[model samples]
Target: MTRVLLLGGTTEAGRMARALADAGVDAVYSYAGRTEAPVAQPLPVRVGGFGGVAGLVAYLRAEGISHVIDATHPFAAQMSRNAVEGCAAAGVALIALEREPWQAGEGDRWTHVPDLAGAVAALGEAPRWVFLAIGRQNLSAFAGAPQHHYLLRLVDPPTDPLPLPRAEAVIARGPFDVAGDRALLKDHRIEVIVAKNAGGAGAEAKLVAARELGLPVVLIDRPLVPERRVARTLGEVMAWLDG
Candidate 1:
């Protein structure tokens, strides 16, 4: 059996692992230990980072890894780059599974910003209410918008204390329900929402809710990735594997 390692954390990561398993490939799924009980996939799994590039290279060579599929989050720039370098060092096949980001449509009020700080800067002082869906890692930027109240939703409790005067945390995972989202928006009296373009159905209903409410959204663009062999879908990844 061919040995494949899947660097997983994204939703499609699980699917990609299953796809490889179905094709009779001996695949091992790896996660970055970021999530609290990430959804289980149908393969042997390893959690936590592989130290760095050197450690990953050692793992690749020692395990006789034939191929590597990077399915980490778009913001995981460091790991993605490490994979590219590590694969080269070990002479292993590498592919990136990246999905298209959600695009703004008619009735979608979007203000595209370069980063999280930029997203906060876009919110002017207006005694506003905002829904911060940017996850647990980077909520400190919102502290600058003290005039605004924020409704922060995260899977885990934030490690650092929030600087906002008025803020609430909702512990939940999604693909959220559009109706429930709409209610939360209405209940919080949110005028603006901040979200990252982490594509796919997981936590996507908030976008739908924002669209329905006609609420303005501050969308953070995805981080840039290094040049790599990319596949937009699982089928495409499977095809690459077959080839």
Candidate 2:
């Protein structure tokens, strides 16, 4: 039996786990436990960090994991790096199941930034209504400029300790429709859209809505992971395993 360690917390991760099970590989789905209401998957699950790369190496060694599949969110750079290094240290094969990043079309308005701090600065000093889809962890950077009213979306309801003071939470999941996204932007009177290029149809409707509304978007670039063999979809991964 192949002991596969799947690092996931994203939608693609769950799908990948299902694919692995269907391929007859014994899989362990691992998460960092950031969200309250996590996405459901077919495999057995583990949560919490591994105390960095050293701890992860220990886990890989003890569990006799043959493969490490990185199906984490694109913004999850640090964990991805840690996994790459840890798996190398433990002599395990690593494959990144990464979705392709979104591209801008002719009518698309985009401002690319290196990181979230730069993203906030690029927004300028105006108190414009903003739709922030940068996830909960990076919200602290926006606290410095709280003059803007933010419409925040998350899977779980944020606790009282959120960074932005004038922010309203919308508890929901996606694949959001273009119509719903347009309505959201219209209802919130959003002037700007801040997002990471987490590709796929799940949150892609927002990009189309932003384009239609002529809203300028501050896009945070996806972090670079170590160069490795990448499978764009679960089908490609299973093919790799078969060969």
Candidate 3:
């Protein structure tokens, strides 16, 4: 009876799901329901939240989930924290599949900020063309600095009007290449980039594109999550499950 729950939303989570299926592990993939169309996975999938720590604990107990793997995006602090608390209460083992944060490289001009608000503050008073690589959820925070024009790349087109007055949307998905991102920056005439330090190969193209074009990026650091066991690769997560 090795039922497991995989808290998922990142590219890494997709890979982990496939591995779990191939291994014939009984697991459920859970999405936060932020995206309109999430990628198909091999395991049974559940969308939306589990209410909170109490709800998550109830689910784990009722489903007999023996283990939990938190393969969510680094910036998804709230869900990650809830998972930690829920698993502890349910007496289930939990491990996080987390990627390392990106670091500044040669030829890159980066201003590091602790969080989203700091990123907004870093974008000084002067008006400029900015590539807002952070997702659509936190776009309203930028309204305070309405002087600059923003280029937003989203997984789905906005159903309602965007929060920013000077913002335009480009509907697309990631696993994006550097050439395409470079062309996007050129075409949009982006002078700076505002992005979260969501570390992974799939979404690193924008940083690479910024480096090649000599653009300054205001990088926002990942939020702190409760301490939990972490695995950096698919092999490691599989090993943990086996153990």
lDDT of each: 0.87, 0.89, 0.94
lDDT by residue (tens digit), candidate 1, 40-65: 88898988989899999999988889
- Backbone clash pairs for candidate 2 read none
RMSD of 2: 1.1
TM-score of 1: 0.93
Local lDDT at 159 for model 2: 73
> Model 3 over residues 1-243: C-alpha lDDT tens digits?
789899999999999999999999999999999999999999999999999999999999999999999999998999999999999999999999999999888999999999889999999999999999999999999999999999999999999999999999999998999999999999999999999999889989999999999999999998999899999999998888888
Per-residue lDDT over 67-181 for candidate 2, one digit per residue giving the tens place of the 0 to 100 score: 8899999889899999889988999888889989999998899999988888889888989899999878889999999999999998888876788999998989877999999
Best by lDDT: 3
Clashing pairs in 1: 174-203, 175-203
> Ten-residue segment with the worst summed lDDT in candidate 1?
155-164
Alpha-carbon runs more than 4 Å astray in model 2: none
lDDT of 1 at 94: 96
